[model samples]
Target: MQTTLMIYDGTAPADSGVPRTGGVPLAPAGFTWPICGSSCGGPLQFFAHLPVEDGVLSVFVCQNDPGACESWDATSGANRVYLFPREELQPVEAPATGVTLLPATSAIRTHVVTLDPAEDDDHDELAPDAYDLARSGWKREPEERFGKQREVLGSLGGSPSYLEDDRLPACPACTDTMEFAAHLEEGISAQSAMNLGGRLGYVFVCRACREGAFLTD
Candidate 1:
């Protein structure tokens, strides 16, 4: 299987239209900052600005009180994902009183990775997850294993890594199962990493409905 890995590409302009994490989101006019409805009742923190094939995926998660809010559940309202059109998108004005943005804006560059089938072994009964296999083999230098893993921002257009079938989200507009869109990692450093409770983040979308969902695992 092939997966497009999102590699960390250093700091970027906060409002640039590029695949990136931790930046002010670009949205259509009249779009207001999404507030965390599940808990904390404050604005959700902007997580990423991903430019996908058909549109941009703007993600937000509750940071005001991470543990207090159910950000890991797709329907919990503590997190949000917007599928906005590519044209006429402008930077949103963040709310002044809540955790609405990240400390830094980190750019991302795509690297297409192809994974070969796992060798026949006792564990071959179950098919290997492509994303997991690709991620594990990302580091080229054995000595820089852990350090190189940190450069992986996430991946695009691949199956969710280790996500359970039951956790897949349904489209709010049509109630249909959504397609997996991307996997997001915390980040390269503690100072800018998204506080995901040491978990991986997932994004899903329903193309026909032009809707999206967010969750963590």
Candidate 2:
């Protein structure tokens, strides 16, 4: 099994304002901060700014109280995600009011890892995010076993992990079910993980409404 490999030195960089995944969040000329509808009633915290096909996927979540807030409740208004056309976008300044940007931005590089069935017949049985399984397999193999680690599950273009299929969210605009967009996890390396405070963030969007949502668990 060949999987996407990410280089994790734990130093992901962002643009001047937003924490970098692919740079700044692109919005129209008169863009304003996304209001958090959660009990926090503040600006949703900026989570990621990923580049999509000809557009940018901007993500944010509520940070009123990491201990008591429902950052994962879809209707709690704790999170927001948006995909804007690149041509119609511009860099955004971090809001002065809401959740503050993380201090360290861990950078990530995506590559690939090739798995050889010959290495271990049981290698085929490992789950996608099976870190323990992969580590065990490596311990049994000779030196220089698998290519780079498949890396943790949450990075650009990868499916969200730790989520139930039935939990797919609905788009607030069209009232139609939204599509699973991406997952944002701790940054590149364990040392510089995006400082998500151990919570995994998920991004969803409705192209028809040009709106998106984010949640954490």
- Indicate which candidate wins on lDDT: 1
Q: Which stretches of model 1 miss by more than 4 angstroms?
A: 119-126, 142-147
RMSD of each: 2.1, 4.6
Could you give candidate 2's per-residue lDDT for residues 48-139 as a string of tens digits? 66666647787766665774567777777767777877675666777877564655554455544445545465546654443223323432
Top candidate (TM-score): 1
lDDT of 1 by residue, 34-151 (tens): 9999968999999999999899999999999869999999999999999999999998989989999899999999999786766413237677877766676685555554336788
Candidate 1 CA-lDDT value: 0.89
Model 2 stretches astray by more than 4 angstroms:
1-24, 114-153, 188-197
Query: TM per model?
Result: 0.94, 0.71
